[model samples]
Target: MFDSIQWLIGIIKSIRINDIIDILIVATIIYYLLKFIIGTRGWQILIGLFILLSIWLVAKILHLPTIEWIFDNLWSIGIFILIVVFQPEIRRGLAKLGERGLFRYSLISKKKAIDEIIRAATFLAERKIGALIVFERNIDLENYTEGCVKLNAEISLELLISIFIPQTPLHDGAVIIRDQEVVSARCFLPLTINPNIPKNIGTRHRAGIGISEETDAVALIVSEERGEISLAVDGKLFRDLDPLTLRKKLIEVLEIEKPDFIGKLKNKLFGKKKWKK
Candidate 1:
């Protein structure tokens, strides 16, 4: 143990400034990669890979030729195997990096987008209109929105409400929102296959939860039967939220700055209500 400590100290002392920066960059990449994959099936795959690595180590120690050979061949194709297994995660990560770079100079207002969504959801809930709105984060949702009407228009309260109004042509499916734009309407989202979900929840809510489970997107659901608002993210559901709670939740998830007292007061003076807690 003392010898190991000495070796570590020597390595630390020998590290130059550039070496330290390189280490920091690599560490940052690994940290974000782990964070992005956490709470997803990618985490399970990581655990399986770790177990296989341990088994390979044991096989090498025991001179088990067959096991060692199998693991060696596996490692040879590991990069391709990982790409296949983690296709969604890789795509999402790349999308996030590309979006950040492209939108760095853009004047997109996330606050306005959140406000529009909250206003539309509140309007729908008051009238007991069922609506599902999926807010895309990093993941590309094009695969799931193939047949939906392509709008690519700026998001607005009126536009959202009109799309979900009862008897409307696009009322049945979900609205896909990306970067403050209404990407599509009547988009069919994936339904959650979890058996634990209650049977009473309708198809709209199920799809809301489903898309959230499969991607990093957030889903806002307004129920027609109960006239309630709900939020779904990371496969977890927050049900029966009031308007204030919904707004706060969205701001938190979207990493928007909280509204100041005057802004909050103005909203309350208008149609929004203040939640005590």
Candidate 2:
């Protein structure tokens, strides 16, 4: 016990500031990794892998030759197997890691996605259809997809409009669009508990504002009572925007490739002056 205590003391003494930082970085990564993996499909896969790893360690300790030999052989291709099994998660993790810099581009046209959403919102607004569309931005909204219908379909005016047609199966909840794909529909977002929100805005708008508060995502809402388009971002809601204005707002927040000098000049010369407020 004295020897063990001395060894522990030595280890504690040997840990420098650099060591502490290194340990902190690793612990932060593991903490976030576990936080992200929990409640995801990959969580079960992780549990299975852990059980297999535990079995391998147990086999070695118990002198189980057959199991040990099998796992030893399997370990050779284990990395490749893992890559295949966790392909989606790995890709998302890498994309998320590099999203602020290198991997910022989406598979689909950002402008096109926004346009489709605008068209759908216009269609919904004209008929007094209430809608909530959340666009995933720098932050991942994967947690919202749970218990929701996973469409995984490309975003389109028809699809977005159909989902919110009154009395439709998915009409009750918000739609989450990530990149150019409508990741899920009928997603129940956390509602803001703040009483400061105007009484005129309903549950749909509240949900849109709620998600924006928690993430960097931008939300487009169609007010059924007023038949106006609104945007919510950073916990604040902007109400009563036209199509052109909404487009500008989405492009601005989403950080899409900004208009060049020529386009800006065109806007200045010919296009309707960008709307304010």
Best by TM-score: 1
Lowest lDDT sum, 10 consecutive residues, model 1, at 99-108
- In model 1, the runs with Cα more than 4 Å from the true position are 1-15, 39-44, 83-96, 99-106, 126-128, 135-154, 176-218, 225-242, 253-277
Which tens-of-lDDT digit does each residue in 1-277 have in candidate 1?
9999999999989989999899999998888787677766688799999999999999999999999999999999999999999998889778868866623743458887888899999999999999999988766676777889999888889999989988889898999987778989989988999898889988988999999999888999999999999998888788999877888888877657766899788768894543332
Instruction: Name the regions of candidate 2 deviating beyond 4 angstroms.
Output: 1-88, 91-108, 259-277
- lDDT on C-alpha atoms for all candidate structures: 0.86, 0.86
Question: Where is model 2 poorest over a 10-residue stretch in terms of lDDT?
Answer: 99-108
